[model samples]
Target: MMNVTRGRTPFLLVFLACTGLLAYAYYAQFQLGLEPCPLCILQRLGFMLMGLFALLGAIHGPKAWGRWVYGVPILLGAGWGMTTGARHVWLQNLPADQVPDCGPGMYFMLEYDFPLMDILREAFTGAGECAEVDWSFLGLSMPMWTLIWYVGLAVFILWALVVNSRGSRPLEQ
Candidate 1:
C-alpha cells in the first residue's frame, strides 16, 4: 500500500548510510592504518548483514505478511550488531592484565588456525587485540560509538516497521 511504499524510503536511506559507515571503517583500516581485530571483523559482518536485510526490505516493500517476514531479518541483523558492539565495548573496558591474550590474525583463523565455528567463537569472545582503544571521538571509543549507532538503528527500524505494518487504521469507537 501507499504506507508501505513511503515507509520504504527510510529503510533505503538508513541502509545506504550503513553502507557509508562500513566504507569509512574500511578506509580507517586501509588508509588510516588502523588494524581491525577479529571482533572488529565480526562487527563488520553484522553491519553488512544488516545492510543486506535493509536493502531487501526496502526493495520488496512487502505488504502485511511479507512485511513481517522482512522485519525478522532486519531485527535479527540489528540484534547481532548490538551484541557484537557490546562485546567489543566490554573488551575495551577491561584492565590490561585482565585482557585476554592475542589470537592469530583473522587470516590464519580462516585459512589454517580454526574451523568455521571455532573461528566465529574466537572472534566473538575476542582476543587481546579487541581490547585496544586506538580510536575515539568526543571521548567515546569506536566500539562505544558503534554500540550507540546499532541501538539507534534498531529502535528506529523497529518502530518504522511496526507503524508501516499497521497501516492507517481508524481507532475503534
Candidate 2:
C-alpha cells in the first residue's frame, strides 16, 4: 500500500542521520582527539553494519521475503550496538577499585594470534580504558547516549516492519 511505500523514505532518512552521528564520532576521534576504547570501536562497527543494511533496505525497498531478510541484519546490528553500549554503561558505573586493569590494544590482541573468542570475551568484559568518561551530555556519557540511539532505531525499525507486513494483509470490511 501507499503507506508502506511511504515508510521506505523515512527509513533512509533515519539511517542517514545515524551515519551522520557516526561521522561525528569520527570527528571526536580525529579532530577532538578522543581515542576510542575497544568497546567504542565495537559499537562503531555495529552502527556501520546497521547503516549499511538500512541503506540497502531503503534503496531496494524489497517486498515480503526480501524485507524480512533485510530485517535480520538490521536487528543483528542494533542488538550488537545495544549489547556493547550496555557493557560500556556498566563499566562506567563501576567503582574505581572495581574497574578492570587495562589490556593490550585491539590490534595487539588480533595481531598476536589470540583466539577470536578470547578477543571477544576480553572486549566485552572491558578494561580500565573502557570505563573512562571522556565525554558527556546532560550528565549521560557517550555510551549512554549511544544506547539511547540504538534503542530508538530498533523501535523505529520494528514499527516500520510491522506496518509494512500489515500492508500485505487483506483488510476486513
Q: Pick the candidate with the highest lDDT.
A: 2
Off by over 4 Å in 2: 1-7, 111-113, 168-173
Task: In candidate 2, list every pair of residues with a backbone clash.
Answer: none
Model 1 regions lying over 4 Å from their true place: 1-5, 169-173
**Residue 128, model 1: Cα distance from true site in angstroms:** 1.0
Model 1 clash pairs? Answer: none
Question: Each prediction's Cα lDDT score?
Answer: 0.79, 0.83
lDDT of 1 by residue, 1-173 (tens): 33323447756866886898799899999999999888788888778887888898788877766766766776787788889888899999998999887877787887785888888777766477899999999999888888888888778777776776677553467
Task: Give me the overall lDDT of model 2.
Answer: 0.83
Q: Against the hidden reference, what TM-scores do the models get?
A: 0.88, 0.88
Q: How displaced is residue 110 in candidate 1, in Å?
A: 1.3
